[model samples]
Structure formats: structure tokens, C-alpha cells
Target: MFQYVFGIPFTLLKFLLLWFWGTLKRLIPYALRWKKSIANEIVLITGGGSGIGRQTALYFARAGATLVLWDVNPDGNAETARLVRDCGMKAYTYTCDVTKREEVYRVAQRVKEEVGTVFILVNNAGIVSGKQFLHLTDEEIIKTMDVNTMAHFWTLRAFLPDMVRSNQGHVVTISSLLGESAVGGLSDYCTSKFAVRGLHDAILREMSVLDSQVKCTVVCPFGVSTGMFDGVKLRHEFLLPFMAPEYVGRKIVQAVLTDTEVLYLPPYVQLLVIAKTILPTSAQLVLEDIIKLNEATKTFTGRRQDTPKKEN
Candidate 1:
């Protein structure tokens, strides 16, 4: 067909021009990211009891967004709501077990009734088992997958319908660097996160092709100082350091405000992603050893809370 034969050059030209304009906008001072005001936007954050989710909830609240906090821990989730209210923003807390599909759906309904349709849905709830294959129980593995991977599907299904009708919403998936690079003791965790990364990419691409205004963001940050991964350590702390939860939270919220998609935190970590693509198997193994990647999680003692380090 002539359509296929003739469309290549135009497509290439459009891609190049778009790339150039994006670069130029970054270089220019006044011309920059299109900032979206979060004032009064209903933001529902899973795992908002503590860690990164709590911090992100606060970040959005400070920017004038109303908060809906979901967590299995009643005390901590209430505390986060109190903090948001202290910031003079409306906040409602719902104790939820994100690993359960029915619970997530039911809680989502209560949120809609008690708060309103969520303008921003941040899927920050996740759990890490920190156990090698076979060492982990069947339940632990399933729980990890449920919380880390399947919860995204349930939460998105519950909230995305309204977003489609309005065509104005943001979905943030707090993934992990482990999703990009496999590691021992984190097989389940990595698999789950990788699935989420793919999920976000698919959703974003679909939205783009449909000319939908719904924005999507996927974050892949190294371990944070949150208690969720209290004992993970690398040979060179400076080379591959764990980030602060506050910093991670702030960055994720900034990405949403700017509609920035696919974040690799601290910037330099992106080089590792590139290396993963180009480096051979042996070289990649050697690099992994140099960083003590596999050994790092051996000592990991994640926080004991039900939703510890929710996407930290």
C-alpha cells in the first residue's frame, strides 16, 4: 500500500522535530515544563501510612491537593491524614489491604463516596520479601506479587474509568531499579516491579495514541533510606547510594506536576540502564559483582509493618 511506503519519512521528520522542540524548551529559561496546578485535586495514594507514600501525600497536600490515604495500618494512616490536615488540606484515611483485589475495589468506592473522584492516583504501595527463590514461602511470593504487581491493575481499574471520561488525570507508578536489573534475593520483588514498569509503558503509549490527556509517570529509584530496606548495602556507598525517602517523594510529585514520564532517580543511574542494554552477559555479571548487587539484599530486613516502605 502507498500509505506504508510514504509514511516513513513524515514519521521520521515529526519525531525529529518533536525531539528538537523538547530540547529547545529545556534550554530556554521562560519556556519550560508545563506545570499543572494540583490545587484541590483529589489525590489518592496507596500505602500512605508511612515512608515514600506518606511523604508524597504531604508533598501533594502542600501543593493544595486533597488527600485520600490508604494503608493497612490504621495508626500510621491516621497520622498521615493528620499531617495533611495540619497543612490545611482536606484528607481522608481508609485502612486498606492493597494485596486484596476486593478490598482495594471496596475502599475505592468508599473514597469516591467520602472524598470524590480521584484526580491523581499514585500506586505507591508495594512490599519486598527479600528472600531467594525456594527460601520464600508460597504465601510470601504471592503476597509480594499481589502488592507489587497485581495491585496496580486493581487500583487502576477502580480509578481510571472516571479519568477517561474527564481526560484529565495523572497516574504515578512507583517502581524500583530492581525492575531494570535482576538480582538475587529479590527475584520476586524484581519480577513484580518489572511487570509494573511494562504496565505503565503500555498505558502511557495507549493514552498517547488515543490522544488522551491522562498523564502517566513511572519511577525507578534505587533503594531509599526508609526502613523497608534497612539492611541493603553496596560495596561503594557513594557509587550506588540509597536515596532519602523525602527526596524520592519530592521528585515523584515534581514529575507528576510537570507531567514528566519514566523517571530514573539521581540521574546517573540511567547510565546503568544503558549499560544493561549494551554490555555483554559476562561484563554485566562482572559489573554486578563490582557493585555487590546480589549480596546487598542478603542482609535486608525490611520494616515489619504490614505496608512497610510502601514504594520507598
Candidate 2:
């Protein structure tokens, strides 16, 4: 019993030392070199018909990667594919209803047969119903959850087996800052994003435990200029402005190339969580009210019943 107790300290010390070294390596710029190449990768992006998804597809196509674009909008998805082909890269597109699990699986099989195995899966598709908790209909809430969170599950189930077997892949979840911090009038949207973060983290840990080479990245950006949050007003534009789609898109591609784990756009967005933890609950409530995040959606006339691509 005495020897077993003594071994605990040494084991903990070793773990700390290794963790410290890992952190130091990550801090060094030289350690971030690409361990995998995108030039030959087959990347599948959901909601790729427009906005950030389209921008990301463009970036990857420029990098010489093949693309499979999936969207609910036929014209938008075709346009994304055309733009990629214009870049001298191959692109295939499908009109898919992500809320339907069987449809996700069916199209995934079609992709495998036609586009080869996807080396990267970007679950960028999401829906938002900017409404007060009491104002939302039951269908709207369920639809939001189905597209934003449940669809992630379906895509992973359809594609992850190949990634697991090969032990080489990347999963990118385009979540939002609201996932971590909640505000009024965004109950349905927040609920879906919050659950998405849960799934992203779980997949990351599960992959680590299995000793798989698969990597997971969760991107949490504030309001973006993707039309989905077009009317979102921010008092501090420089510090907390709505990010441009091009900038957000490029950052996502960079994260995947460098194997970044969690990326909060503009960097300082991480401080929200820090403030919440350090401040009292009353103080936190005051901060949210002062930022007008609660009222940000008051004038929200964003596209109603809009799919991610539909906002384009």
C-alpha cells in the first residue's frame, strides 16, 4: 500500500513534464508545420453552396484538393462546384437534406463511390431561429436541433468508419461563440450550437483514446457577415465586429492544415468564458446586458426558415 501510494506522485510528475513539453512545442512557431498535405486530399463540406462554406471550398480548391459539396440548395451547390472547377480543381456536388439521416447516409455512399474516400469532413451546415424561448414553435426548435446538432451525428456515422479504419482524417465543426455563452432571443440556436460543442469535444477525446490519427477542430466565431446574422449589431466593431466570410473561411482552412484544436476567431473571444468564470453570476448577467447581445436579435430580420446555404 505504501509503495503504491509512492508511485502516484512520480506518475503525476511525469505527466506534468510531458504536458509542459507539449505546450512549449505548440507555442513555438516552427512546431506547427503541416503533418498532412491537403493538395491530394478529398474534402467533403456540408453547406458548401454559399457563404463561409463556399469560401472554404474555394480555398481548399486553390490548395489543389478535390471537393464534394453538399447543400440543400441546388443552384448554390452547383455554383460552388462551378467556381471550384474554374480554379482547375475537380468538384462534385449533391443536393442533400442534412436533417434526414437516411439522406445523409445515402449521399455519403454515393460520394464514396464517385469521389473516393473523403480525407476531411467539414460539418459546416447549421440553422438558426433567432427567437425568444417562449416565442419559438415546437417545430422550429426541433428543426434547429435536427440540422445543427443531429446532422453532425449522421455525417460522422456515415463517414467516420473509413476514417477510423485508416486512422487518418480531420473533422471540423463550425460552431459559434454563442455556444459557450448564452443570450436572450437565441434559445433555439444556442441550444443546437451548445450540443454541437459537446459532440465535437466527445469526438476529440474518443479519437485520442483510440489512438487514431483523426483530428477534430471546433471553430467558434462571433457574428459573421454570412447573412445568417446580418442584423446583429455590435457596439465595439473593431474588437467584436461581425467577421467577414472570407476571413473566417481562410482561418478554418489554416486550422485544418495546422491541426489546431479549438479556434475562437479574433482570439479575444476566449475571454468571454474567462470573464464568466471570474465574475459573479450577477456581474456576468450585467455584462451580457451591457453588450446588448440580448437585444442584438431584437431587430433580427434574417431569412426565416433558412438553411445555412439559403442565407446566401
Note each model's CA RMSD in angstroms: 2.7, 3.0
| CA-lDDT, candidates in order | 0.86, 0.85
Q: Can you tell me which runs of candidate 1 are displaced by over 4 Å? A: 1-9, 22-32, 304-312
lDDT by residue for model 2 (1-312), tens: 222344566667778888897677556663456545789799999999998899999989987899999998889899999999999999999989998999999999999998899989999888777778889999988999998899999999999989999989999998988898888888988888899999999999999899999999999998778878756665555667887888988888888888888888867889887887789989887777766768888877675444442322
User: Which structure among the candidates has the greatest TM-score?
Assistant: 1
* Candidate 1 residue lDDT tens string, 1-312: 323334566667778889998667544442356778989999999989888988999899998999999988899899999999999999999988887889989989988988899989999888887888879999888888899999999999999989988999999999988888888888999999899999999999988898999999898997777787777878988898878888988888888887777778876788888999999989998988997988887887777655454553
Collision count of model 1:
0
The alpha-carbon deviation from the true structure for residue 266 of candidate 2, after best TM-score superposition, in angstroms, is 1.7
**What TM-score do all the candidates reach, one by one?**
0.92, 0.91
